[model samples]
Structures are given as C-alpha cells and as structure tokens.
Target: QQQVKQSPQSLIVQKGGISIINCAYENTAFDYFPWYQQFPGKGPALLIAIRPDVSEKKEGRFTISFNKSAKQFSLHIMDSQPGDSATYFCAAITSGGSYIPTFGRGTSLIVHP
Candidate 1:
C-alpha cells in the first residue's frame, strides 16, 4: 500500500490561469509528502511539501492542499506561466528510519502563452 497514484498524466493551461494536479496514496504509514518539479535535461528539485499534521501549505504561487482523512493531496499553481511548464512528481515517505520516497508516475504540465 505504498503506492501513490497521480491523475491527469498531462495538463495544459493558459498563461495567467491555474494549473492543478492531484495525487492519492494508499499507505497511511506515509507521514512525509513532498512535491518535485523538473525541467528537461535537469534533475527534479523540491518544490513544496506538506505533512499529515497540516491541512495545507503554500509557498509563493504554489500551494499544496492535503487531506489526511482521505489520504490524498493536490498541488495548485496560481497564475501559471510558461516557465512553470515542467514535470511534477508527488512522493511520500514513511517516518522514522527510512527516508526513501515513493514517487508517483508524474504529471507533465504545460502552460501556453
């Protein structure tokens, strides 16, 4: 039950619009959730994250809304720009010793100008 399922394998949005991606996990043991953004030919970098203790977290134009009871989370990008076009991944990891994250299949977002 360590799997994380992401939806809308691909998304397209106009500039100044909002882009949203959703993810769900089956493992309640996962206590740490992080999102990553990656551009072509570059490694993924940490974008934003949220723990079960918090219902939501926001950083700049990016926001993560989490539902501990539903075991689900989503990322919302406001005023999406072309520069925001990239592959996003949602991951979860267990607490305590192991820090290895279980990643979703990833969602590719493209913002049109």
Candidate 2:
C-alpha cells in the first residue's frame, strides 16, 4: 500500500476541451489526495486535492474526483489551452503517519492550437 500509478504518456486536447487522466493507488491508509502540475523542468505544483472523506473536489479550472472504495482518483482539466500544456501527476499522502508522497509517473498533456 504505497504506490500511485498513472498512465497516458501523452494527451492531446483541443482548446476548450476537457482533459481527463486516471490514477490508482495501493495504500488504503492514504488520507490526503493531491494532483500536481509541472511545466518543463519545474517542480510540480499542487493543483487540486481531495480527502478520502470526500467524493469529489473542484477547483477553478481543475477538478479532483476520488473513489474511496476503489482506491483511485482522477484529475479533470477544463478549458484546455496551449498554455495548459504540461505534465500532471497524482499523489497521495498520510497526515497522521507520513507526509511523504507517492507520485504517479506523470501524464503529459498537450493542448493543441
């Protein structure tokens, strides 16, 4: 129970399209669910997150839908754009136990012109 796996080596979304990526985690003890967005060589930034207690959470242009029973989570990007082209990663953390995160390989999203 210590890994988060994501797929889709690359994604192509038209402008204003909705981009979706899925992730599965093994650790049932994970309480904090966070999705990070990284551009090129930069560090990943926390884009959105949800706790196991919640079914789903939404941010401005991003959304995180969590499945407690399935131990899975996904990130949705709305209004895709060329500017939004970046790598996305889904991660999980434990507050009471450890803050260290298990990150998914990453999903590279490309919003076409």
Candidate 3:
C-alpha cells in the first residue's frame, strides 16, 4: 500500500513569513504528488503538484519540491497570511491507477497577525 507521512501535525507562522512542511512516502509505484489546502468546513483544494519525472513545480506562492530517489516531498508557502492559514495535506497515487490518494494525517497552519 502507498503511504505518505507528514510531520509537525501543526504549525504557526507570521503574516509575512514562509511556511514549510515535509512528507515521506514508501511506495515506489506512486507517481503523483499533490498538496491540498483546506479551510474550516470546506473540502480540500489542490494547491500544487509534481510528478516523478520533474524536480519541482510552482504556482504563484505555492510550490512543490519533489525528490524521486529519496521518496520525499515538501511544500513551501511564501508570504503567508492569516487567510492562508488552514489544514494542509500531502497525498500520493499512481498516475493511471485509482484516483483515490493516500493522504498524510494533516497539518494545521495558523498564521497570526
């Protein structure tokens, strides 16, 4: 089974600082890396993603850095704000396999003003 594990179950950041989170996986068959952000009472939204064929992918303030050999990945948030505070989850799944993903426990980010 594909398993992704996340750390620091929670985090706190200043309104203008950067927030970083890490994740590790154990399945070599997994080929997709996606990060999701979720607000209270809402569903998670795809923040960014990277494939094993690529080293990294960035979308605005959100970036996903992938490591194929190490079987690890990380998410970086720049210029974080109160509005950016929410739960972040890292997930993995095979590209052509079932779309359902194996997710990390979750990290609650709280940006204080």
> Which one is best on lDDT?
1
Clashing pairs in 3: none
Order of quality (TM-score): 1, 3, 2
Per-residue lDDT of candidate 1, residues 1-113 (tens digit):
54999988999999999999999999889999999999999999999999999999999999999999999999999999999999999999997958888999999999999
> Worst lDDT window (10 residues) for model 2?
1-10
Number of the top-ranking candidate, with TM-score as the measure: 1
Q: Give TM per candidate.
A: 0.96, 0.93, 0.94
Candidate 1 stretches with Cα past 4 Å from truth are: none
lDDT of 3 by residue, 1-113 (tens): 53888977999999999999999999899999889999999999988888999988889988888988999999999999899999999999887888778999999999999
Cα error, candidate 3, residue 89 (Å)? 0.6
Give the CA lDDT, 0 to 100, for residue 113 in model 3: 97
Q: RMSD in Å for candidate 3, one decimal?
A: 1.4
Query: lDDT of each prediction vs. the true structure?
Result: 0.95, 0.89, 0.91
lDDT value for model 3? 0.91
